[model samples]
Target: MRFLLIEDNRELALATRDRLTLDGHVVDHAADLATAQDYARTMSYDLVLLDIMLPDGDGRDFLAYLRDIRSDTPVIAVTARSEVSDKVGILDLGADDYISKPFDFAELEARCRAVLRRRAGTSSNTQRIGDVAFNRLGGTLTIENRIIELRNRELRLFELLADNPNVIFSKPKLVDRLFSFDEDVSENAIEVYVGRLRKHLAASNVSISTIRGLGYRLDIG
Candidate 1:
C-alpha cells in the first residue's frame, strides 16, 4: 500500500514512516499542512494518515478540500484529540477512520488496510477471484492451490484488477491506485508491470486484457 503521513511532529512522522516502509508500504511524509496540500494535489495515495493539529491549517479543512476535489481517497485522522465530537466531526466530514496520537504503529497499519479494504469493496482480509485467491493480511496469492509470491505493488495491482473482473482500468487510474507520492512512475511504468504480471498469470490461464483505447481489464471469463 502507498500512504501519505501528514504530521507536524518530526519524531512521530519519522517513526511512522519507518514502520510503514518496513511493512512493505511506500510512504511520503509532510511536516506541515502546506506541504501536505501540495503533495495531495500533485500525487496519489492509497490512504492519508493525517494529523489534525498542523502548523498552517486545520486538518479538517484539508479533508474538506480533498472531498471538494472529488477524491474519495480514504483518510484516517491521527490526532491527540480523543473527544467523541471531534471523532464524529471528522468521520462525518468523510474521514474513513481515526487513530489517536501516541498510538501503536501496528494498529495504524491495520487501520490503513481496513480502510482500503472497505473502499475497494472487499468484505474482509481475504479476497477470491475465480480460481485465484488472495489473503490481504497475509499478502499471499494462490491460484488453484499453488502459492504465487508477489511484491507489494504486484499484490495491490492484482487486487484492483481482480476486484471487478472484466472491468477496464486506464493507465492513469492504475498508477493512482498503485503508487504514492514517493514513487516516481509514469504510464509506461504501468505497462511494464502489467507485462510482468501477464507472464506470471500465463500459466494459470488468467489474462489481463487491453481494451484498445479504453485500458486494461482482468478477464476471468
Candidate 2:
C-alpha cells in the first residue's frame, strides 16, 4: 500500500518509513503540514500517518481539512499525546485510529492493517479470489495452495486488484498506488507489473483483462 507520512521528527519519520518500506509499502514523508497538504491534494493514498504536532501547524487541522474535502482516506494519528481526552478529541476530529508516541513498529503495522481491513469492510485479512488467496497482513499470495513470490511493486499491485476484485484500475491510478513520489517511473511501468501478475495467474481461474483504452480488470471464472 502507498502511504503519506506526516511527521516532523526526522529520526522517527525515517524509522517508520523504513519499517513500512521493508513490509513492501511505499511511503512518502512530509515533515510539515504544508507539504503534506500538497501531497494530499495531488495524490491518492491508501492511508495517512499523521502526527498531531507538526513544524508548521497542528496535524489535527490537516485532518479536519481532509474531512472537509470529504476525503475518506483513513488516517492514523501518530502523536505524543497519551491522554484519553486527547485520543477522543483526535478521533472526534476524524482520525480512524490513534497511536501514542514510543510505539512499537510491529504494533503500528498491525494497527495499519486493522484500520485498512475496517475500511475495506472485511473482518479478516485473508481474501480469496478463485484459487488465489491473499493474506493482506502477511503480504503473501497463494495460488492453488502454493505461494507465488512477487516483487514489492507486483505484490502491491496484486493486493490492490485483489482487494477490489473486478474493478477496473486505470494505468495512472495504478502507477500512483504502486510507486512513491520519489521513484522515477516510466509510462509502461503499470503494464510491466500487470504482465507479470498475468503470468503468475495464467494457470489459475483468475486473469487480468485489458479493456483497451479503459485500463485493466481482474477477471475470475
Q: Please report the candidate that would top TM-score against the real structure.
A: 2
Q: Which candidate is the best by lDDT?
A: 2
**Scored by CA lDDT, what does every candidate get?**
0.83, 0.89
Candidate 1, residue 205: lDDT? 61
lDDT of 1 by residue, 61-118 (tens): 9999999999988999988987999999999999999999789878988888888889
The per-residue C-alpha lDDT of model 1 at residue 158 equals 77
Candidate 2, residues 24-124: lDDT per residue as tens digits?
A: 89999999999999999999899999999988989999999999999999999998987899999999999999898899998999999999889878889
Residue 109 displacement in candidate 2 (angstroms): 0.7
Report, for all candidates in order, the number of backbone clashes: 0, 0
